[model samples]
Target: MKNQTTTTSVTTGQMFRFVFGQVLNRRWLLGLNVLALTVISLLEFVIPQYEQYIIDHVIPRRDLGLLTEVVLGLLGTAIALGVLNYLSTYYMGIMSQGAITNLRTELYQYTLRLDTHFFESSKTGDLMVRLTSDISNLQSLISANMLSMIGSIVTFIFVWIYIFIINWQMAVAVTLTFPLMFLIYRVFRTRIHNAFRAARASQAQMSNQMQNTLTQIDLIKSYTNEDLEENRFGAYAQTNKQDMINATQNQAIFSPLIDFVNYLGVAIILALGAYFVIRRQLTVGQLVAYLSYVAMLQGPIRAFTQILNQLQQSLVSYGRVMDILALKPAITNAPNPVNFPAIKQGVTLDHVSFTYPDSDVSENGPVLPAVTDITFTIPFGKTTALVGHSGSGKTTLTRLIDRLYDIDSGTIGFDSVPIKDIRLSSLRKNIAIVSQDVYIIDGSIQDNILYGRENATDDEVWQVAQMADIADFIHSLPDGLATQVGERGVKLSGGQKQRLSIARALLKNAQIVILDEATASLDNESEKAIQHALENLMKARTSLVIAHRLSTIHSADQIIVMDDGHLVEQGTHESLLKANGAYAKLYNAQFS
Candidate 1:
């Protein structure tokens, strides 16, 4: 299968628009936040004016009453600033949280709908990182840093205009350094972004390694390869550590350089203001106020450097997230899809062919299709058995029947209805599969069984469990149906897990049943019991069974033998044995 990572590149402008678009979902909250920030910026500008007045007028005139009044005005402005800051923060919290929550949910829902091909080519750990860590990065950007960056811009604009009004020459002198700081940021921007991207990739690799190792810990222990696994994991961790340090180092260097340029701007303002004040071209009070304004102007410039760092990292995360969101599921319902009817004629395949989209190529040429030009019929209310060697396309045939993948050529029909024409949800709901590799969720026994039929009553659940011959096992457990099954049903034995799978499939009560080595995990006694249960489950249903054990299918209504992706033999078990063809060969080998 292809291992290429799916990625979508978006321009900086596009990224901002998308993130802000989510924030805009709560329009009123965003509007209120902007208003609060604007008032706070104006209040910040007003405070410097008060400082100028006190120094130039109140102190010189020695008017106690005027001083008291100006002080009261400053006090009131401070209170207003506090209130506005609180409201702004609160409003931003609501907007950012709501936006991130909605975006995260949308991403998850989209992922669930994606085709199996996408998942086969993707790592579970990397996908988890994108959904969780990457989303969290965006939340931080939107909630705290982004609004603060906006406020800084507003404050800078107000302060810049005021300083120019008080003294144009000083404003012009300090402004020269502004371009140099921007130049520094522009020069370092791509480098910082590249570093952050590398870090993010490294983190994904590390997460993938951790997930892989943890999931297969039992295998590692079986072979006593814990040290080997640990060493492998350590390598991933080391790479991640280095990449993060590299990103942090780039940010560290970038910020200080910007700060150095900002200090240069401050020095120019100081020298020019002092010269003007001494020469009587500017009042000391006006010079002080200009200095204060210059300080305010520097705030945004400094903030820009920090924001740039955050912007680079957030952009990396944004790209990762958008890459997933941009993907359109390969398998989607046709326009005005036909609702699947109850099965009567059963499934039919007419010269069907399928090649996995990501199938690996040999050095000489491309590999053969998984199933090639196959044709067969699964008649209603009958059990048809498929016997094949490993990789003989038996399981692939079952998946094709269920429309897990669309055939590359010809067609698969469900009760004479073209499978693709049927609504995907409706088609899948009517088919139930019990495969060799049973998957049991980490939940109570009842929860896992109910997954097959969520609305099934307690009595109905027990009935199916009894039919699957697992009711006695449940009764023996202290918690019975409520018994906790650890992650992947780790608490249960293989036989128990398989039995639960049978119970779940029995509960689904689907019109078509597929048993793909369903009894492989069961012991001799359990297998005998489950075979009886299977007889009941398959009765009056269109059933398809794939088994390596030839003995199990002796009573099947029809037996089909497959070899190297081709149907080689078909007949009743006795006829196939009498013919002594592929089915007889497999039967004799197993029996011998």
Candidate 2:
């Protein structure tokens, strides 16, 4: 698990560029939307001119037939604009949604393929938030919001041309307010950016709390810390509320200010036009046309800034999504992958050494190395055990062999080729693991056993279940193998869950087996059944066992003892006990 509350930096312009770039590849869709929107913008420009013509020409001449014709023309064009706008928005929606879905799928797939080191160094909840909320933000930006901003910009450009054509002097006067408006918009943007960052930080904090709380709800209730947890949650929520308020205030303040600027700009335009009309420099109709054009331009102008604000949010989320997409898994298959037929061919670590990239005590603290110069071998069809104290690097050594992590130096090999050279799918296919913390989905007993290997027939499922000694109990159940195991197999006892996990491994029919504290969670009866299952599974396979209980690995063909990233002892259990070293001390301490 990663430490809480690490900050991410993503700017608005970068996000817009990334998202827009994604759209550039879809030339057909882009052409369709832009063309439709262009027609709509052209229609919008015509509406103001048509109104000006009706007032200046038809009304002055008092020709009712001309008046009726112009009214119908404007109505027809208005309807056409609406249709074009709908078409543009419709196609844009499809393109945006498709892009977002594609991006999200790739992001999700990349996250799953990342090495265990990345997962260990990152928070699950933060990743979850990125997958859900951040994706949603991007989706909105693409689908509806972004297209509207594009339309606004197009409309502003067309309206500005009309304003300039009517009277240059008046156009210049209205344009002057823009710089002050932009200055005020800049101030609003700064405040809103800070507010939004705070809002996202609070959200991240809240997500971490929820993930921890839900996972450990039983612990909270057992320790009577529910109230404490609630207090912590509420405190974070309060910060979220405050951040939202600040963002709302920062953005909301701009609306009235912009409106005031619009009002003042219009007032100045009309007053100047009135003086020109008195001086016979401009007519009533020309003044009215300029005023109408300015009014039309104001909305699109204000909308442009509002869209820019939303763009900032999308950019932040875009950065987060890009981060996950760009993260290369530390452990990946070689360019030309090797395929291993079976794991019984044995495995070897030739001078393997490993240290976590970001696992350090402090800035200048001594870095801990988890494995060092570890040269060892487990021969084919043999059961080998690893014995170590906590933090002695036992788990790290197992993970190294599994290639959940890559070794910093030397090589780990199976079938005479480095594990890294083997295709990831082929490598994992040959091994099965039964760990202390067994996981079962909320599914039928059969489904849990055959998870991912679900095509196994009824006979095959039952065959493995019997070997794991879970068939008899499953048969006794009213639903047999169809019995629904509740979330994470909570419906079953610890011993029962362990047996089910063993059955799963048996069903895999893998050539290598790893038992990581597999029987530690069980009672004697359950442990005996699991041991029986292990013996059956290991018959023709190589096996590596990590045992806390001393008697579990007593009959192992070999035992390797580890302490502080180094091998302290290796031999048969009896020989190690006779050696009276770290292995002997551990054995006596547990069994004495």
Q: Which candidate is the best by lDDT?
A: 1
Residues forming the 10-long window of minimal summed lDDT in candidate 1: 1-10
Give the TM-scores of the predictions, in the order they appear. Answer: 0.97, 0.94
Global lDDT for candidate 2? 0.81
lDDT of 2 by residue, 61-89 (tens): 99999989999999999999878877877
Query: Against the true structure, what is every candidate's RMSD?
Result: 1.5, 2.4
Lowest lDDT block of 10, candidate 2 = 1-10
lDDT of the structure predicted as candidate 1: 0.86
Question: What's model 2's lDDT at 267?
Answer: 97
